[model samples]
Target: MSGSQALKADALDFAGDTATYALSLFVIGASLRTRALASLIKGASLAAIAIAVLGMTVLRVMNGAPPEAATMGVVGFLALSANVASVLILLRWRDGDSNVRSVWLCSRNDAIGNVGVIVAGGVVALTGTAWPDLLVAALLAGLFLKSASAITLQALRELNTTGASHATPVESSS
Candidate 1:
């Protein structure tokens, strides 16, 4: 790829990664408002992992080789951690509310994405090519975008129903 192409690719990757982190805040924030403590903690953890991955990927791109590989190794581990934690947390959620289910689905999607990241990292290490790394980064961003949209929509729905009650109000006999 030419210098401009490489730069564009990097820009896209960073933007996506940043958006992923930003969405994590929403997840964590929504979980807090809903009083889902476990989900909150998990969201926080995932956010941290995402930041680490972003940092590492940037460092790898700029630095090169062994260091890049090392960072990719860390990304792989963190990806696994994020996935496992998300799955476990989602499993504990009892309510089927759309908001909660949205969160659960995000976790489920992320877990799958994490596996892709791991594979991409391994491929990069084996082949010493940028494609694998870039592919994974793009895939992660896609996953983030998908989850963020779902969560935001669900949260809006929840907020819109603020005054609405599932149960009927009792009528006064006056």
Candidate 2:
């Protein structure tokens, strides 16, 4: 591929990833406002797992003799599944706190990552090259890591705030 072509491809991948991430964030925020956070996260987590599994099956069937497709498929599925499961498990608490919020963020981010993987698979199946698939997989991994870290930090902040609020006793001037 020419330099310009490579750059264009990279730009497209980044744009797609960003769009998916933004959509997921919007959905999550909307869910938080309109529905219970716990339920939203749980439902998203389940959906993500299902999507990952479906992607894997598609890849397996499409992946012919070359091992690259199969390998990428497995990695994509595992990464997505693991990320979703981790977030769900971490946010098992019903008391909507920083920890739970953080987990929800992670789940939301992973859902985007899952979409990226599926897109990458489609690109690979069409182009029959490993580079696009690899690029997307790597990008997905980075997104997951970045989102997970942010979620963790946010959770800590929520925890601290909750603690402070609970620690302060109500002042009554009788």
Candidate 3:
């Protein structure tokens, strides 16, 4: 396994992506308000992940250990491929509301993060320093935080504009 903090951050973000995507799926046919609420939740979770990544990145910087370059390159490439495929598929829906946009942004961010990891691996191999890896992790954390803000803002706007009550309905199962 790669000792890359950037890779760990990527994995953490991907885990958040998986959970949010599942939530998105559940609300696909829901009302606009519901979708907006879901998007807000997703945004909050993304922000949480970003904070977590920052904490780890600081620890990695203090540790100052270079990752395994070979492993980082291979894994980053594979992750990039998968995320790029997702980005292509989600391109058309990227213009939609926060619920839809969140998915697109997450995929795009994944690809970007993967690229950073790959570059960091190369830099670490060349310089034999942990700076590149730690820097990439910090940058990825910032990316996540930015995306979180965007998603949350759009979701709030959608929630305000949607013609519905703010309170979510409680489903009754007979």
Highest-lDDT candidate: 3
Each candidate structure's count of clashing pairs: 0, 0, 0
Question: Using Cα atoms with residue i matched to residue i, what is each candidate's TM-score against the true structure?
Answer: 0.50, 0.40, 0.92
What is each predicted model's overall lDDT from 0 to 1? 0.51, 0.46, 0.93
Better of 1 and 2 by TM-score: 1
Evaluate model 2: give its TM-score. Answer: 0.40
Q: 15-123 in candidate 2: lDDT tens per residue?
A: 4344434444555544332323333343344334334434543453454332244444455566567666756674555245433454455455555565565566656
Ranking of all candidate structures by their lDDT, best first = 3, 1, 2
Query: In model 1, how large is the Cα lDDT of residue 93?
Result: 58
Q: Which ten residues in a row have the lowest lDDT in candidate 2?
A: 1-10
Give per-residue CA lDDT, model 1, range 70-96, as digits (tens).
455555467658667867977875255
Best by TM-score: 3
Colliding pairs, model 2? none
Candidate 3, superposed: residue stretches over 4 Å from native = 163-174
Clashes of 3: 0
